[model samples]
Target: MELPEVVSRSEWLVARKKFLAEEKEFTRRRDELNANRRRLPMVLVEQDYVFTGPDGPVRLLDVFEGRLQLVVYHFMFAPEWDAGCPNCTWLSDDIGRLDGLHEMQTTYAAVSRAPYEKIAAYKEQRGWTFPWYSSAGTSFNYDFHVTLDESVLPLEYNYRTKAEWEALPSGGLVQGEQPFDLHGMSCFLRTGDAVHHTYSTYGRGTDSLGFSGTVIDLTALGRQEPWELPAGRIPAPDHHADGCH
Candidate 1:
């Protein structure tokens, strides 16, 4: 790895202090943005979307497990695919357990279009303790804007329509094989047996939720994705890997 320029302890301290001030400002702004996010209006989920889990069929509210808030990661595992997306799996690796989230009155789970049997087997193989469900034979994925119909030209993703995606190629970031599912995250709130969709983010918006990426961001490498890093500070060619689809 290329090291940064060597500097005296005094010079390092000066730079660190300056950076700390900027960090504090960033933190404050982030907190304010979070407050605004919480204040966004929510839409009532009236559709009776049912998902299949290891325990059998379960409604959207049932996934909450009696919790007032629910966080669902829309895993990209199409019904015919043998496995889930590698990128989604990479994010899942950072999800250790649910005990902490549960204590905060939140329930978390991964939902996919794959069958329940496939989801169960994959979850066990990965040693995941959190609940995962199959939304196959339902419009849950489409309703949430995670999965798109192949017949619809120009895929809708990350809140962008197909035309917008095509305008900015970004090395085929939005282009890929047809009839495939995408990944996303959705948040919900339950009130007196009524469920409401509080928020949902797709594509890069969901990147910050993973612990592994946060750890990498703390380092000089900073994810090492092509889009990140300074022009001359890019990593060696061999270090690059095909990221999310």
Candidate 2:
């Protein structure tokens, strides 16, 4: 197996120091980017999207759980699918107690296109405690562009159209794949009775939030997705929503 060159302790320290400098620079740039992201404008959420939860049907505002901010995981579980997307489950497995988020006046939840019964069954099967809801028979998924149906809404994913995606070499999947649900994270802010859409990210944009994905990213092999450079490091799995698309 290939590995990094082994060297003397002193030599390794020098190389580590050089890498540390680069890492620090990257951290600074990332801090600036985070600041810019926080400053991005938010949109007013006018649509009254309702979701079915364990307790029963609830409006979008109710999903916030009276929190000032809401972070939603657009889980990829189509209405017809018996189970959630494997890739989405991969990320969901990393979700632990979110008391920290709650303390910060934020509520985290997962929304899927599957029926509440299916979502509840899967959630229990995986032993997940985080709130999961169903957007079945609602436009919540369609409005968020997570559930793609050209007949209902124009095709758009990760801020790109079908044509835009097809133009890319790795975008062939989008050509034939339609009326499919994709995974994403969307943030919303509640001010009194009004809910504002703060931010939404899809595809690789969600990588950072996935603890498992983030840890895998730090390894030599990376996430083993097709888009990663030095390709064919390993056989990429058939990932539905969260993987490269």
Candidate 3:
């Protein structure tokens, strides 16, 4: 692909210095937050869960295999749905392409409450090659607070930060209580054949990790504005719900 035009040497150097300083500060802040996150306490997982793989039933701990880290995408596929959530599809499309960077040193997989046969068929239909398995006959999905009888709204006070959530219904993903379907990157460390589920994040509802939205926001930023819909985009939640249609 053709690249954008480069700046003059002097201008490029100045820009580089500014960018490097900003990046260094961002890196420092990120490391500090991660340190705090790492120090957060973990809850006891009392349930012994198992999942269905191509081979057969595999214990939850066995999913990590030899990899030191395992990130599970709690895909939005429940027993009643004929298809996965479109938002999840949007995210998973990116994931399928990302699963194979040789140097990343991380393993990515997906677990859903749907049965293996059903889940496998869906993956095949989507032509997705990423690791996906079924959580049928297990409490793992529920334990992860991604599945249950009724929809969960994070019960604590929801903070609005991300653009999509802005002007969405005022009631937000409450910080501490919603047992909703969580989109998360779970990190793990493996030992022998047993792996420990190390860390996960819930509400404040995940912010942009700098691939798509954040960079776009930084350029044509609007989440800070009146939270209006983009010029050509669809109407906001409030407008639609208040009978604007």
Q: Model 3, which residues run further than 4 Å from truth? A: 1-24, 41-46, 96-105, 150-169, 172-182, 203-210, 221-245
- lDDT tens digits, residues 1-245, model 2? 34567799999999889989989999999999999999999999999898899999999999999999999999988888899888888888999999999999999999998999999999999999999999888888888888888899888877778787667655543434567888899999999989999999987778777798878877867766645656335524422335523
Candidate 3, residues 1-245, lDDT tens digits: the string is: 22335779999889779889988999999999889977876554445678898889887676765455677877767665677766566556554364453246567788887778878888888888878878877767655655533343222212223344544665433233323344444556555555566776443133332244354555534443344455447864433211000
C-alpha TM-scores of all predictions: 0.89, 0.90, 0.62
Off by over 4 Å in 2: 173-177, 231-241
lDDT of candidate 3 vs native?
A: 0.59
User: At residue 108, what lDDT does model 2 achieve?
Assistant: 95
In model 2, pairs of residues that clash are none
Q: Clashes in model 1: which pairs?
A: none
* lDDT per model vs. reference: 0.82, 0.84, 0.59
| Shift of residue 213 alpha carbon in model 3, Å | 3.5
Give the Å shift of residue 147 in candidate 2. 1.2
Model 1 Cα lDDT, one tens digit per residue, 178-229 = 5667888999999979999999988767877799988887786566665565
